[model samples]
Target: MRKRLSAQIAARRKQQVPADLKGMDASLMAMLDAQIGDLEQRIKGVIEQEAASAAKARLLLSIPGIGPVSAAMLIAEMPELGRMTSGEAAAMTGLAPIPHDSGAMRGKRAIAGGRRALRHVLFQAALAAASHNPVLKPVAQALKIHGKPHKLVIVAIARRLVTIANAILKTGIPWQPQPDS
Candidate 1:
């Protein structure tokens, strides 16, 4: 029992530090800080690469939430959006739930296809849109009413956002989220 008690004490000591800053030694912290700086520079490079890829994507920056990298990833990955209908584009990104029907029975809504990375970037944009754009927050709130999972509702909005973004890119016009009327 004493041995177990000592082990527990040592474990608690380790857990006292926050996970993000668990280690000792100033030199280790310095090295981590330098690496973080380098990573920031690399992220900057990726953002620039995205900006240079398409003027349409660059226009996405006009929207509050989308940055160069997110816009670029959307543009590069969602090429069909430029050619397909808004709904089709959204479905392709796996934002729309696949309807499963049966005789007098129905399963819950589920997002199929692991276009998860695209979904994540778009969701970020949606979050920004909901917070800043006068139009989207109400829509998000309305969607929240059905007792749907918060993430699914966000995913739905994110899909709608991509549809809106597609039009902006194709028409060479600035994005304007639909005003809540």
Candidate 2:
């Protein structure tokens, strides 16, 4: 609803709209902003209410590209994170590239199924990781250098992010930078 309203506001700006329409849009935007803030606060409160969840949240937050929202999403949406293998984690989030093949016919690999909402959250995290994560930044850059499409690069980064998150959770360790090679 907020995104739709934002689009409506943008479209309104392109026209000579009435003053009342402008005022309505402003009011709706303000209301939506307040609700979003409240929701975020509620999510934080829920995470902190459980000792185990709080610990998991801390571990997730230690990752460079994952912020509070992403951590919350992971904790809430993907409860099986720590118990699974890295490939299983990626597959659960729909970041795993599935193969398409048959008798004498091979096709491109694509990701499918799993928790769609969690996948979007991971994609957003991957976008941040591509820019800021010490380990992932070089991988993203190298993919770009090789002329991979932007979506492909981001998907790759997202897969890696889930794998790292899974490993960290499984081991109960905060993310630590690798030593210089």
Candidate 3:
């Protein structure tokens, strides 16, 4: 909605319009920005509150790619994080690849059927990890080097992120990037 409004404002500016009308659009954009800011602050406050209640959230945030939003989402949406296996965690997030095969025929493995919102948030976090997290960056690079498609690489990273999150939660340890051995 914010993006759409910004685009509309830009478009309006490009067109020949009355000054008053342009000003109205600018005013609306400012209002939208303020609303967005307010919502972000509220989200931050809620996340902070939740983190206080669940120490696991603080542990989750210690991961490079996992921010307050991702930590809060995981704590709220996936209460089974610490108790689940890595594969189970990935499956829960819809990052696990599903196998498809028949006698004398092998079909492609694809990911499906899990928490969609959690999957989306994991993907976003994966993208950040791929670029910014030292420990996970090589995983993304290796997948790309092996000719994996962009989305496939992202899903793989998301799966890894879920596994890492699970491990940290289970162990009650903050993330410490280890050198590849």
- Candidate 1 on 73-102: residue-level lDDT in tens? 676677656667887778877887787878
Kindly provide the TM-score of model 3 when superposed on the true structure, using C-alpha atoms: 0.81
Candidate 1 lDDT score relative to the true structure = 0.68
- C-alpha lDDT of candidate 3 relative to the true structure: 0.84
Residue-wise C-alpha lDDT for candidate 2, range 35-141, written one tens digit per residue: 77777888899999999999999999999999998899899889989999988999999999999999889999999998998898899899999999999999999
Candidates' C-alpha lDDT: 0.68, 0.90, 0.84
**Against the hidden reference, what TM-scores do the models get?**
0.68, 0.90, 0.81
Deviation in Å, model 3, residue 171 alpha carbon: 0.9
Q: By lDDT, is 1 or 3 better?
A: 3
Clashing pairs in 2: none
Task: Give the winner by lDDT: 1 or 2.
Answer: 2
Question: If ranked by lDDT, best first, what sequence of candidates would result?
Answer: 2, 3, 1
TM-score of 1: 0.68
Model 1 ranges with Cα > 4 A deviation: 1-52, 145-148, 177-181
**Top candidate by lDDT:** 2
> After best superposition, candidate 2 residue 45: deviation in angstroms?
0.1
Of candidate 3, the 10-residue stretch with the lowest lDDT total is 1-10
